[model samples]
Target: MKHGVTVALLVVAAMAGTMASARAQGGRIEERALPYTPLPADIQALDEVIKAPLTDDFVAKSFTAPDGRIVPYRLLTPATATVQLAQARLPLVIVLHGSGSIGQNNVSQMTAFAKAWALPALRQRFPAYVVAPQVDVRSADYAPGGDGLLASHPGASLPAILALVDDLLGRLPVDPARVYVVGFSMGASAALDALVAQPGRFAAAVAFSAVPPDRDRAVAVAGTPTMQVHGDQDTENPFDPDHAWAEAVAAAGGAPIFVRYQGMEHRVPPDMILAPGWREWLFAQRLKSAAPFPNP
Candidate 1:
């Protein structure tokens, strides 16, 4: 097997026994089990699953920055918009793909959190826009380093991504009031930093296996309702730093919901996205401020 695929299998299999033990002791990754368990082989097939497009309809989209930088992104419109495309505006969920999903292809990133949103059940219940943008590796080093510090800015894609999001709002039926963000691994770290960069734009966040917080930046976005989930056994991104970050956020008056999966690791089993009303919880959160898409 290829090194990356082999590594992915090992990570998932190794964490399974631990997670099972934790669940037996009442551990949960935010109101749901990891969702891919009891069959190690199933967990191993994640790479192929992630590579396949969740739906054939995700539209190819782009945003051109002022400096002539064009960022590529894939967009999924809900199959059940309430009103006509031009007049309707529903909640929007911005999904950031993990390190493995980064590519110029545009759709590779759609398989992670974005796939969860594409579920037949979720598509019917939480009819909203799902946007997954591809992050290029050359512009920045995405991997968190030795001490769990990311090599680049946590919100490095800030201005460009936000510009794309803003443009989506204008052209598509996206409810500016109900915007939410969710991501795993490097993407998770980026999601949190995105909140810090532009506070009040995103009403809530679900960051899993996220990198350690940029304390100063993290503390700035204390008001946003956020959920942090990590496996104590996560070697890719150590568990303690994320736990401490959530604790610190709460200490600083941010109500971050932290979930420690007993034996989980970096792969984080994307199946958690389909565990009950996870998307609903995200859609329900609303920013207290009246301003739409809060500016930096």
Candidate 2:
């Protein structure tokens, strides 16, 4: 009986030690809910969601490029983080704002959706760094692609944005293996540009209502995991092209998950944004060299 009790206690101690090690490594999560949802009425609730005020925790700052262009941004440190955990590294989430939110004030870019990351629930559940960069103009340059659709390339501001990310990684406990970018409308297009611009830098990308870049650039981002969410009824940046982009990326051996809202218009669906699954999918991604990426 004494021998058995000693063995059991040893096992329990080993288990506890393993759990502590996991916590020290930043508690990486791999669970994700369903990725696709088609809701017709979700669009109606966006106004309320958009008007939601941003929390005060996101500290405002500005990044100035070598060329002197300034990009205003808001940064949110993990609510649970502190100076004590010297070896801890956490994921970094970059949020891009739509055209309507563009400005140098640093606060206009704090859309209701962008503010969601600072929510107590989200901060507690997925504590990490969140940065929202505001540019004076579109983050990517757009010109007619000669096929009646616009072709996009990285704009001048993008380099600064990327530099800002590097700055954060240098100064913060950000996990380079789990960097992510997300945006809506024009910002969505910029997010894709950023992903392609720095391929292999981002673990994953989630674009909402984005304009597709030129077909030739599809292969550049073929290895990165991506999710494109858009409403079928979108008129601002036609949905068909974005859909085609997804297909093209898939054809180029890229992994892309396209979420379509059947009867919605040119707007981000509030229901999906506020869903736990969205964060679950975003947080589940980590840098991987293999294909057939995990389905979130």
Whole-model lDDT values for every prediction? 0.63, 0.70
Task: Write candidate 1's Cα lDDT for 130-240 as tens digits.
Answer: 888887652223445444554235545556777776776667656677788888788887787678767878888888888755554556777776777777778877776
Where is model 2 more than 4 Å wrong at Cα? Answer: 1-53, 81-87, 146-148, 289-296
Across 1-296, the per-residue lDDT of candidate 2 in tens digits comes to 11112221232234323433332343121111222343444444444455656547789888887667898899998755442453646788999888898779888888877887876666777778899989987787677654567767777788888888777777776777888999898888888988778888888888888887876678788766677778888888788777777766766766566667676788766665655555666777777642222221
Clashing pairs in 1: none
- The TM-scores, one per candidate, come to 0.75, 0.78
> What TM-score does model 1 achieve against the real structure?
0.75
Q: Best by lDDT, which number? A: 2
Which candidate number has the best TM-score? 2
